[model samples]
Target chain A: MGMPLELNTMIVTKGREKRVEENLFVLVKEGYRLYPIDIPIDVKKTMDSDSSGSAVIKKVEWENSSTTITYQLVSLNSTN
Target chain B: MGMPLELNTMIVTKGREKRVEENLFVLVKEGYRLYPIDIPIDVKKTMDSDSSGSAVIKKVEWENSSTTITYQLVSLNSTN
Candidate 1:
């Protein structure tokens, strides 16, 4: 069956450390049932600051089941 | 518009190291354009042997665009 769905993308920075980490851990713990794959960091972009970086995180949540799978594009240099 | 699709899942063991790694790298390099989320591993099962482990990998590819996103659930102990 084809399911109608919406995809959400988030760009997280180093300053959002706590939020990002928390979200990531949650996704890691519960993502498998929703997605058949592992979340990978594909593209990374570094900003001017040493401690801050920008990344694109893709999260796919099933509209019917409410299950979610999250993937992260981490800045290679970002400490978080 | 909703697209008709099929999802493929693979179970990989340590013996298929090279194939698994190659497929993973390809998915990483080309996955973003397909899905909006990162792939995560929620469950891992370890076998009797020390060097081998088993995992489930989910890959989503667009039938028309031919874009693919790959997620890996690696055996935590698998070296490669």
Candidate 2:
């Protein structure tokens, strides 16, 4: 059998992201997933939320069945 | 041009790994990389080092030009 994995084109933070630095954020997710690197992708507070901003992932770490990602916000669609 | 990516069949930790549980470990590496999911692969302290163990990758994540993998040690070839 194979592990369940997902390929994503966006970041749905679900309000669990932590600000690691100015314009940079880190988020941890459950399970194995894939995202495009060095490219811009949409970021939202949730899957159903409106697009909040654009970000470029700078690092991703997976361990203990969790995925941790570091990203930098490139642009914001709205302030609120 | 497309992003640079590597498909890896083994893990060379280089002593940069953190043990999360008894048999589970996490490793993060620079650059986008791919590993087989749910299958056993070689694990070593370095590329030149002998295989330390066999591990089944449970998760692989790519982001920001880095690859993160979570694996479970299945069998060890040595005690050291």
Candidate 3:
């Protein structure tokens, strides 16, 4: 493969890390390689009740070094 | 590009659909083309306070048709 697809993750410290890993692993078994994006951990706000967005790190390998995933929001309702 | 990467999603009526889409979109513009895997929306439990782990749909495009991202959970503490 060239550059792997980038996936952002967050460990809210709510203790769902395992479940989240399980979620991520599901994707891995499909074919894509895993490589964690190496960047300064950012204290960003994310979904969930936790005040700290707690970004999930240790992403995965794939792609031709695109750096990260990309895309812009287009709708409130995703029908496609 | 062959088959686009497959991502599983769930839309619990918890009201984070917009946020999740925003999350997914972040990945798209990165070089991925999304396509929803047409399956009967499975009523499964997910990670959250929400009882139903509503699956997000309309994944993207990229790659040589592998059908989904792949990898396996290898550690409790993801260092890489």
Candidate 4:
């Protein structure tokens, strides 16, 4: 048998006031043990002249520990 | 050099009235031309006794055309 892998996906958006908020999905798994892991932002970029996005993944805590990963998307202003 | 690959990510959610709604991301690319492609639902599942999720991808229209993939997440009732 192999270790289980938990997969999670999230879409982050900025509110009308430009406040950052995240809508998180409950941990979902197919055939692996589910564990909560934090994902770090691997990359961030702005696009479409309006939106900013970031990719994040949880740091690997242990060699055999289950991990959860998440990505955040946001909108950026031209000035910033 | 290899063909360009366009990547898009979306987080879909159900509204207060149990209506399915999707927050779409404008096409974002790293180093490829982006052509709008529809993503079909490949898999669907329910989790946490509350949320229903589905993975979708656009059918491969051409041998070397850019593709766009999207995943939709929605809340489900236990009855269905």
- On lDDT, the candidate that comes out on top is 2
lDDT to native, each model: 0.35, 0.84, 0.31, 0.27
Candidate 1: misplaced stretches above 4 Å?
Answer: A1-80, B11-24, B27-64, B76-80
Maximum-TM-score candidate: 2
Q: List the residue pairs that clash in candidate 2.
A: A57-B64, A58-B64
lDDT by residue (tens digit), candidate 1, A1-80: 33333332232232323244633522322232323233333322224445333343354433223343444435455465
TM-score, cand. 3: 0.19
Query: Cα-based RMSD of the predictions, in order?
Result: 14.5, 4.6, 21.5, 18.4
Candidate 4 wrongly placed segments (more than 4 Å):
A1-22, A33-36, A41-52, A55-80, B1-80
Model 3 residue A48 lDDT score: 44
Candidate 1 lDDT, tens digit per residue, B1-80? 32333332232232323344642522322232333234333322223444333343354433223334444545455456
Give the alpha carbon lDDT tens digit for every residue of A1-80 in model 3.
12243244432232322333332311222234233344422222234443332233444434443222211111222224
Candidate 2 stretches with Cα past 4 Å from truth are B11-30, B37-39, B43-53, B56-80
True contacts kept of each: 0.00, 0.58, 0.00, 0.00
The TM-score of candidate 3's chain A against the true chain A comes to 0.22
Candidate 2 local lDDT, A42-78, one digit each (tens): 9999898899999998877666667788999999996
